[model samples]
Target: MTRLGRIIQRFQSDQGGAALVEVAITVPLVLLLSAGVFEFSNILNTRLLLSAGVEDAARYMARCSDSTWNNCVALGKNLAVNGAVTGGSARVTGWTTAEITVGKTSTAAVDGSGTQLYLSSTGTVDVVQVSTALPYSGVVFWDFLGFGTIDITASHQERVVGW
Candidate 1:
């Protein structure tokens, strides 16, 4: 047999190189998938935490507000901060400052349509809303995903029962 023919035969029979090539191709894909899952999970978890904080703030305002709404916004923001810091602590991890906005708005003003759903300028104020914006650039793959700093916003509203 010719030398080239023998070499060709050996190459065709070789299974070892095939496994190496397959691994080289598949390993990166596997790694990328794992990273994507981790990032997505982190995003979802953060959002849930923020949402819970907003809910707590809105509920408190709804039940507690009276003739005086003084510092009510501050109260809600503080409560939300506590929830964010405590709930997000996977082990001493917390944000020092989160963009939190708490305010009173009329049901009609936010009657389901507006750019700032939690805001009210006029009319009978009967709704308490807690809104928050968090910068989610801390995710492990956030940079890899090309999202410099995704701003995640969460808001919750509750009707003021007494006034």
Candidate 2:
């Protein structure tokens, strides 16, 4: 056999580089999957935190007294962004009170039979809603992956119960 043919045969039969080839092919895939899991978890955690903060603010505003109603809205916005009535660090990075919206709504409740269930004489229930749309800034570069400007939106509503 020719020398080049013998060399080619030996190279083709060699298993020494097979493991390296497999690792090279799989390493990036494994890393990408791991990074995806981490990113998803991070997003989920941020969503949960935002939801909790919104719920807390809504509950606070719902139970606020009529006399303190003026301060309730501001405090509720603070709570939704900072997780505290007073100004403090935000629950999520880059979150701010500017992103939060606090509002009161008058909604009618109905049972499964479609009959109105009104507790107040006005036939409408007062609801406090807290909401925010926060832009997600991930640990990795999401924009590079074509996931442009992901926003995490959360909202919560609680029935008004004044003291």
Candidate that would win on lDDT: 2
RMSD of each: 5.5, 2.4
**TM-score of every model versus the real structure:** 0.73, 0.87
Q: Which stretches of candidate 2 lie over 4 Å from their true place?
A: 66-68, 111-122
Q: Per-residue alpha-carbon lDDT of model 2 for 4-79, expressed as tens digits?
A: 9999998997889999999999999998888888888999999999999999989988887647776888888787
Give one clash count per candidate, in the order shown: 0, 0
Candidate achieving the largest TM-score? 2
Where model 1 places Cα greater than 4 Å from the true spot, the runs are 1-6, 65-68, 84-98, 108-125
